[model samples]
Target chain A: MRRSALTSTLTFYLPLWAFLVLLLFPFYWMLVTAVRPNKELYNLSLNQLWTSHPTLQHFQKLLFATHFAPWLQNTMLIALGATVLALSCAVFAAYAVQRLRFRGSGVIGVAIFLSYLVPPVILFIPLARIINELGLWDRPAALILTYPTFLIPFATWLLMGYFKSIPVELEDCARIDGATRVQVLRHILLPLALPGILSALIFSFTLSWNEYLYALVFLSSTGSKTIPVGLATELITGDVFQWGPLMAGALLGSVPVALIYSFFVEHYVAGLTGALKE
Target chain B: MPSVQVTTAARVVRPAGLVGRVLENHHALGVMMVTPALLILAIFLAYPFGLGVWLSFTNATIGQAGRFVGLGNFRYLLGDSVFRVVVLNTTLYAAAAVVCKLVLGFLLALLVNREFRGKRIVRAIMLLPWIVPTSLSALVFYWIYDPTFSIITWALRRIGLLHGFINYLGDPNLARASLIAANIWRGIPFFAIGLLAGLQTVSPTLYEAAAIDGAGPWQKFWFVTWPVLLPLTVVVTVFSTIMTVGDFQLIWIITHGGPANATHLFGTLAYQRAIQGGFIGEGAAISAFVLPVLVGAVMVSFHYLRRE
Candidate 1:
């Protein structure tokens, strides 16, 4: 019995640490590469794991030489804009689908899920054409307009799962207390569904911030680029790969969404599992 | 917040005016409530989806208008060696990555499901890769795979495991392997966190009952845990398959479907043909070909939705 317990504990702890180390190694590499000075970065003799003296030169170059600021601003604007739009649409759509029980509500629910199924790879071609026709090509507004297509479906579905869990009976007493449908929704349901709303917000925000394909297709100008497209396409030039500024850009770009995620991770996980559960 | 005149809103519910008549029917209000979402879906999503299918039937190019030539683009794709390689590569990429994620994720979930201090923090760390933008993270992967400065090569050489550079993304086989490794890294969190949630739902009493039946830990897992986790496993499978199959940015950044197109996925190949190569029709056809599989996933998810 002692031997069995010992072996099991070893098996569990050993692999768990391995998983953590392997998973975190890349981000560690990103930070190390980002801040490592040029002299040490090229020195094959120096210890590769840690740099003796780190420099902010890469971030300096990234901020001044490149369109990094514009890209960051663009990403933030698009993500927030898309999140708000998707949430409003999702809030009403989820309420209607989960609560209204009107004719064809079931059909609409199915259609929304089907829309969520459509991937950017499939839509980008036609969307590019549409963007051109609208003369929104090479504009950040193009991304703002298109991102909600994917976001709203996901947010709506997630919110639907959330609203479904809040018992219909919770609103029964509130409605009898002279609370209107809108009142009951605002007072009784919305508060209960706030976690769902926040989760949807986080999901949509991260998704839009992380979006690559639509932003890549719609916005091409350096001044208008989002972080993902800018870092992926423009950061590298010729065979002289700029590893320093590149990693700096990557590390910086990831910080906003990561910060938001750390704050609401509990609700985020519930919303995520709830999303897949449906 | 919007105007909150529920007192006046009640009058509208009873049809005191023309607008009241519209508000009186809950069905009308439901449609009204969903209009913004419906409109967005109709114009941007549903129309574009249909347009993509139509474009696939035509010989569309970047600078020129195309006429409908039904099945012509697909006919070309059927014989195209590059497209065939793309099909093979995509299937291999998704399959390899999905299998690695499933196995590793199941193990990780099992290990993490145990009561441990700072468990929340550990799970948060696991979610890091998924949280980071794929393009940015994939750039980090690109550097890790860089020929001269590759860190993996450095570490392996340090351990006396390798004498020379590993050529992580420089050769076809190695490049495909490298891309799959990155995909697995990003995909693990989705499966781990997802299945861990499933693991928590299984009652302790069930395990206790299995224990009392003289079932060992292995037997307990096989009999009690497996059956309970099966439905969740199915859901996770469908979700992962669809996302992995259609993934583009990860491939584009890491390998760009390079090393003689050994790492080309359907999504990346479609982008190359349509956008980069300017053969929009063929690209649409390449992309549309994968629709049936995605539709299958959607049907499965929809079945779940309906059941819910």
Candidate 2:
């Protein structure tokens, strides 16, 4: 049945359009400010949203003048390092919990989930001291090591659901066919659980990619700073906010994760809904 | 009699030595599998949590250790008006942010639950705010709130709506409100996504059944939809509160507790005191205060999470 025009507009179209505008405006403004010529950006007399003289100078400056490239590298290395570490641990732990079904496994699973509830804000203060003690202070390793404190619990939780979805009968058949336990998991379970693994990787990567608090607390030196910390710190020199390149960095910083996300959008959303769906 | 004899024979044999059995046991394998995750969580998460508690009671500095001051940090925080303001701002920020996010999120969730054209694309687009890094989006907000060059201020001035540029971030109350608006903007999508998942599980059949009963739209929603959304809403709100209370990014980028410390949340305050201010003990104490609230919230929400 078709919805009437008046009811449709009032109920769906109006709110939908309004929500769209609210959400998209900031990103649109980010782009406008990024490309707008400095004169136009600063001058109030010029059109507020429209930029007649847009330039690539900010992007140029961001690449050549700043340590943005290293910041990107630093962010990439840190995110990847953390994602890999977390995913491996999660895979094994999830496999054990779901497949092995050993005594106390249920308790450990709940314990790990409980750890996920612990926020980074509380731990960062003490973690800073630990990083200092381990001599990982001011390095990417500090972030890599610390990110798992959140990522593993999350990834493990998601993977536990994934592993459980696979039938135990398949593993039983594999074993009956003389496949070793390791071989069965490798040939059957891992392939079957590929989607889950992809979701976990995407999530772990994004978690570390978008992380700010730990990066801010641990990495102080400019050269070692990740994108979030770098953008906030290095861009604003004293009181003058560098609008153009700051937006440039902001836009560019989001690209890697956004790219990864759109590529695996289906899996990401599915895994999320699946995990939270009760 | 034969079954009892078989059981007795199996019990007597026991499959061999205790050492060999333990080696091949499922529990041992389970422990081995969970070792890596357990190790990381223990070293990084568990250790630091306990350490934070210990550090809070000491008079520790950045590099120097001090003897136990025993409630000195808490007593000092009680006396410091800045800390008092921090607590007030944190509570206000969280409560306001939570209410806004839930309301807007609920509206958006209901909206998106209805079938429409290009709904998939619309839903994906709705997620953008939550997807991008807050540091980046908060910068976008920072630029918008700039005292002289604010686009919002300029637009109002141009429309003859105001005599001068509005100081969105410069005013204390305005700064706090602006930060909350920015926060709500980011948070709404997460609430929407999670609640939408909840909405999907209600099954159209439930709605159809209500419609057949001649229930009005409002009645249908209140009777059917609201009850189904309750547990999920609780789960999401609890999760959101934990994250929001612990939040540091949006505040740090937008205001940094600026305009006379109007917008400092607990996380930002803790970072300021411990990391930036180098008062490790005090910062630790500030951060620790939220623990009881977080644990309480988590315990309450645990039922909702484990409901299935």
Q: Where does model 1 exceed 4 Å of error?
A: A1-5, B1-15, B302-308
Off by over 4 Å in 2: A1-3, B1-24
How much is the lDDT of residue B102 in candidate 2?
99
TM-score of 1: 0.95
Candidate 2, residue A135: Cα displacement in angstroms equals: 0.7
Error of 2 at A123 (Å): 0.7
Q: lDDT by residue for model 1 over A36-141, one digit each (tens)?
A: 9988887777888899799999999999999999988889999998888888988999999999988999999989987887888899998889989989999777
- Model 1 chain A lDDT-worst window of ten: A174-183
Worst 10 residues of 1 chain B by lDDT: B6-15
Per-model TM-score on C-alpha atoms: 0.95, 0.95
Summarize candidate 2's per-residue lDDT along B1-308 as a digit string, tens digits: 45543343322223356654654467886787799999999999999999999999999999977669999999999999988998888889899999999999989998998889988888888888998999999999998898888878888889989777778888989999999999999999999999999898897899899999999989998999999989989989998999988889999999888877777888888898899899999999999988987888878788776774
* Model 1 lDDT per residue over B1-308, tens place: 79865554342233256675565466987899899999989989998999999999999899777999999999998899888888888889889999999999999999889888888899888999999999999999999998878888888888899887778887888898889999999999999988988898899999999999999989999999988887788789788888888999988988888878877888888989899899999899998977988978877865754554
**lDDT digits (tens) for residues A48-81 of candidate 2:** 7988788999999999999999999999999999
Candidate 2, residue B277: the lDDT equals: 90
Q: Per model, how much of the real contact set is kept? A: 0.71, 0.76
